[model samples]
Target: MLMYKVTKENGKTVYTPHFPPPLAALDGKTVELQGYMIPITSGFRHNTFMLSVLPIQQCMFCGQNGIPAMVEVILSDSKKEKMSERPVTIKGKTVLNRKERNRLEIWVTDAVIM
Candidate 1:
């Protein structure tokens, strides 16, 4: 439901993710995005995985604009605790500010291993 779509445009890639637009309380702050942890990078992400993102299209590698709202998760702790590659709900503080960036970039904050 919270997935963002990535498409190609004018020889450049376009990354438009639907996220909770900036709010007064969330300004200059970090919030949590809960979804199925995916590894965009192959060798780096395998069994041990988790991905922090505003949407699927918010990839730092392929995204034409450096939207700072996307973050990759490398689950270092017990991978067993992290589950579901499909789609799961997670909550974390918002670390990336769209207004702060001149362009798009991925932004992420570490999740609490509870």
Candidate 2:
């Protein structure tokens, strides 16, 4: 889950996303997660995509889930085999992108479908 705290710095108000200490500790570590892939592009063999805890119909963007339920996935092989609709297990190094307000909060780099 994510938490937010507002603070005034340099005479400007800033809103930041805060993860639980345990979740934040996972940053930069290799981890495995299971989810359904949501393609960011038009094809099935995508290097970059979104992994959702729920199916597309119940994704966070649809107002059915929270931000923690999705992650941005970047495959290690850009030309890897096309992904299936079924849930898949992926392994990669985790990245937390808290500063980017307009993007997915979590990212997995060098991901491989397992």
For this target, which candidate reaches the highest lDDT against the unseen true structure?
Answer: 2
Candidate 1, residues 16-77: lDDT per residue as tens digits?
A: 64455544345345555565455544553243343544344554555655643434443334
Question: Which residue pairs does candidate 2 place in steric collision?
Answer: none
Q: What is the lDDT of residue 28 in candidate 2?
A: 98
Instruction: Give all TM-scores, in the order shown.
Output: 0.35, 0.78
List ranges where model 1 is wrong by over 4 Å: 1-30, 44-83, 97-106
Per-candidate clashes come to 18, 0
What TM-score number comes out for model 1? 0.35
Model 2 residue 99 lDDT? 88
lDDT of 2 by residue, 8-112 (tens): 899998778788999999999999999998888786577888898777777666786574368999988574557667899999999998889777788999999
* Cα lDDT computed for each candidate against the true fold: 0.45, 0.84
Cα deviation of 64, candidate 2, in Å: 5.2
lDDT of 1 at 45: 28
